[model samples]
Target: MEEYKKRIIKAIQYIDNNLDAELSLEKVAEIAAYSPFHFHRIFRLIVGETLQNYIIRKRIEKSAFYLALRKNLSIKDIYHQFGFSNHSGFNKTFKKYYGKSPSEFRKLAPENFHKIQAKQSKNGQIDTVFDQYICNIENLLNWTNMHLKIKVTALPEMNLAAVMSLGIANVESSFNTLVDWAKTENLFPGENVKMISVYHDSFKVTPPDKVRIHACMLLDEPLKRQQGEVFPEIIEAGKFIIGSGEVTLSDFEQCWVSLFLWMKENNYSVRKAFPFEIYHTNFKEHPEGKMAVDFCIPIN
Candidate 1:
């Protein structure tokens, strides 16, 4: 990755880890090693939103996560945890984006946890990934054909050369670029190179418009950046329930819905962390033009 993207990601990670705290633009910019003015423009260009907006959205989303999953937490606990000044302000913002008050959303969310019907209004849009995933998951529960060999296991740590893109539409193009860069660098020391799409946000909770997809190639070891938008990132080892099977492109959403259903049935709680898809064989290379993939979901 270029120096700028690397720095921006550093800043973003910091923000994500500290959403409850006050995030001054100057401090965030300093973390990115850029001036506030320069950082503001770059953040908007790359992340598709102003720094403050990003922070606020993350805070609201985090609050929603607590409200939906951590029922032990009260409304005040959720809002205060995210640094809201008062219940009124939090309610105002939550209603704007979710098209419903926090209390009402909480009441409706239990029957369909991770299936909240956030508004798609352009004036108050959900993140792009959330929208795409919502469309993918229409009638998801009705899907009973999903099947695969799935179990929780430890995934070994991996270091990858990654390229990020927004939306599902652009993922293929970005991944192709990363693949070309990796091949040119002769970094494929082993026959098997892991192709991964690392998801930063869960669609179930996040509103649509901004979806982060990092197309990555597993590297044997870290190598200096030579070219392209490739940057280094580490996926820590964790317990993830993985379902492996062949899925047609059209059935992709069904597969995920089925996996989540299975996870719920087996008494696994989803965590706020990265989940991923591992491609065993290229879809284009498959005999039936299907992707031999492993759908992995993080669990607590």
Candidate 2:
């Protein structure tokens, strides 16, 4: 099982690095050191999707991101970047998956883009709260230069004391709640405490009501899980891209999105490990009225 996991990680890396190429089952199977037939079977068992489906999903995801970020790039160029040989095929497939054409999606306001991303249909139904949140996040991203600095480095394993929240829509409230808890437990600003948050679901893909966020503290060593309230997770050692800055509470969402888009542009593929933040200073005590935060994304 361990060997299979290692090979699968390599296979995923190969897929991401060559996403623009014509990837085939046989080629990827060879990369994983497995027969094509066996590779297909095991891949489906492990990934819950066929190899072809996974490839197409990743390509479409990248194309959608390109559509959102590279406003000047033409649809033809975007399609070709994802290895789609023809416009019609790309258009049909993209529209079918996103419930709108690429051009249409690109033209949507940031708020509508969020609604559409959350899979809300355009049947004249409006979600005011969702729209407002997305608009706020987009405004911050547009106002700031998100890609200030990025460095890829090797990271050692880390253990964290964490508090998990479900369906949290307000960052300030949730963050304050976590901080208050840490303070109550006397866990704040200890020699080993580094405040961070682990996002388990992407807002673009997961519904707002289903999102999971883990507010955590860096621990010198692992701690036993305390059932529901607090738990421990080992962040596996891997290659990671790090981005740091003085950012406001609102900047967290924008920072993460920008980091991922940067990764795509730089040809780095994200690994399966959970991405997290590393806080350098207290959120409430930053002299600049912003948190000094470092975003860490696992990658190859």
Candidate 3:
């Protein structure tokens, strides 16, 4: 990868991880080891949005998630948690995109969960998490009803060799590239190898066409040297809520939805880490083309 592209992606990872905190462009640029003007330009060029706009939209999107799913927090608490300066400013911005004030949005969340509506806003991402969450969750819920098992456990950290794939359209190609590169380095599958897709952005809050993922091969052997677009990433050891089973290609998204629903139903809280999918069986090689996959979400 170009050094600049890598830097911007690193900066975005930092930005997304700290969405609930104050994010000044100067500080973010500094973290990326670039001057503010240079960082700002590159960020917009690569991410397709101004830094300020991205931060605000991300904050709003996360706050909306909290509002809809986290019932314990008051409206004031949600706004403050997301770094809004004042109640009025948050209300104005939220209403412009969601067409509902914070409280009104909270009130409609449950109803929206049951009956999803696709309402677009100026922002490329859908204005609310409910639209995406509801769409996926309902399908999973209906198919399995109360039968799906969600397991909460602490897992050891994993090292991954990966390549960045932007947009869902390119994920398969990226995975193929990752496997080919891994083979060249003598880093191909061992007795047990996991194929993972680490999601860097939430599909509920990001536009479908622009979602980012790292197509990864779990390292059974330590890689001697790593660099470039195909690189190494560590999925930190932590408590995760895992839902695993044999699923078809279309069942993948549905299973993720079911996991989130399980989280909400059990009153579990999510943490800051990225969620990942681990594939045990390559669907392409299966007789019925089904994969034994695990959908995991980090939790507090």
Best by TM-score: 1
Which pairs of residues have clashing backbones in candidate 2? Answer: none
Where does candidate 3 clash, by residue pair?
1-229
Regions of candidate 1 where Cα sits further than 4 Å from its true position: 1-6, 70-77, 122-146, 188-190, 222-228
Question: 213, model 1: CA deviation in Å?
Answer: 1.8
Per-residue alpha-carbon lDDT of model 3 for 89-118, expressed as tens digits?
999988766667889888987445433333
lDDT for model 2: 0.69
Sort the predicted structures by TM-score, highest score first. 1, 3, 2
lDDT of 1 by residue, 1-300 (tens): 357766787788789788778899999999999999999999888777899989988888777766766666799988988889899999999876676688987886654654454556556564212223343333554453344677799888888888876556678988987877877788653478779888875556564456667888887887465354777877787889898888777766667667776776677776667778888777787788898888888777
Error of 3 at 67 (Å): 2.1
State TM-scores per candidate.
0.82, 0.54, 0.80
Provide the overall lDDT of each model, using Cα atoms, as 2-decimal numbers.
0.75, 0.69, 0.76
lDDT of 2 by residue, 132-244 (tens): 44445445445435444678999888887665554556444556655676777677647756877887655674456545567777777687744334556678899998988
